[model samples]
Target: MVFKLTSVLALVAALAVTGNAQRQIQGITFAWNPDTPNGSHNLPKNALAMAPISDLNSKAFTCRTNGLNFPNIKSYSSTGGEMFIVAWDMNALNSTDGPKLNGPCNHWMASTAAGTDNLKWFRIGEVGYSAEEGWCTDKIRREGQLVVSMPNDLLPGEYIFRNEVIDLTYAGKTYTDDPTMGAQFYADCLKYTYSGGKNPKEVTTGLVSLPGAYLATDKGLLLNLTADGKPPGGKYTVPGPALHKQPNPGSA
Candidate 1:
């Protein structure tokens, strides 16, 4: 009887640890890096709203238990530079489904980290935002007085990827919360103006990671780290540095 009791206790303890570990990953938070609209356009300086996305267990969405299992992304090149796989598959939850950005700004495609004076954006996925972090450690340069945005028609706008979402069943109550459904992405977007780089890109941080064999995907950048249940910025691999350049105004 004593041996049997000990075995039962061990099994219960193992289950408890497994359950707790699962919840730890479920609790993921995200941050928005803010910036202004244009240079003379008086764009805000490093602006962000703080989306704080927490994807708790919701039987409604029917998301993969192994977290968001994104499909293999695709990439292409055109006048718009290079459009990499922004998201695996996406479905909006509501009107603000596009960007899911911080502050009130949502619609954007490419953004820099230095500041917003040289920020540029495009349209893909939805309007606002998704889990995908736009333009990772990237470079953007602007010279002309003209505000550099997009093609002959693409305007500087921000929207969210919100559509076909349902209420999250939390604590026995259906919360009509909108979290953009799509595979996360990261971009290596670059912008250089005629004047070269009088304008600087914006820089900011987003989202918190969890412990254990971790994984992250953004456009072309992918990171696989082990937190061992540690806090943010805890010993991690140093993937090759971000894209860099020295604006050759002489080429002008």
Candidate 2:
């Protein structure tokens, strides 16, 4: 589902004309500080300012050509475990449909290329609906500090760390008539370069494309928060290609 620029512009225009209220959704602005050389002491003050446009397609967002600017590739060691954390801003504006939905379901992925336009992406991890808590409550609980780790065996190269949150609270029968079918997506792409891994083989399987990577009808995308017959133990099948298994950090 490649979204054309005109289509995106049209959607934005429609939202503007309809006077849709914007909800404040969380976003990932910083890489794991501990993995960086100087930690938080040297991190940028306004990381979100460097982020690409928040939209359905990851490639539509901007990328630093020089790869040395603010929010550029933050180096991490493949041997040592590291993670990227979402820096939430309670004040950031989002679609009104988000809060009405069932979740802050987190979807995280990595790609060897810089932009998501026609790029092959690999799923890293996902946190979907939980059965222990009710719908609205779960959304609020998952809104803070969403985190995902870089595979320890990832081949060293320039890569984009893509973090996405899907709100499905409005996915039930009541919202079937809604143009978006009550699905809201918030995505962020951060630049990164991995080094110090023993494996030299590149990961080639389990590749998927963004926009096309997810379908609104996918069970994980359109969920019934209050239904008792949901997947056992609330386990979710994230809507994307299977996670590519890279070799362990020290593997030959």
Of candidate 1, the 10-residue stretch with the lowest lDDT total is 138-147
Residue 37 error, candidate 2, Å:
5.2
Best by lDDT: 2
Q: Compared with the true structure, what per-residue lDDT tens digits does model 2 show for residues 1-252?
A: 112434322322222211221322223322434323432222233433322222333344322122313355454333323544444433233334333334544344455555534567777766655566544324444443444555765666677666655555455522335554545554555666666455445667777665557555666656565554344356765566776663454343
Point out the worst 10-residue segment of candidate 2 by lDDT: 12-21
Estimate the Cα RMSD of every predicted model relative to the unseen true structure.
22.4, 11.4
Write one digit per residue (lDDT tens) for candidate 1, span 48-146: 111222233332121222332222111111222211111111111112333331211111233323353333232222221222331111000010010
lDDT of 1: 0.20
Residue 90, model 1, lDDT? 12
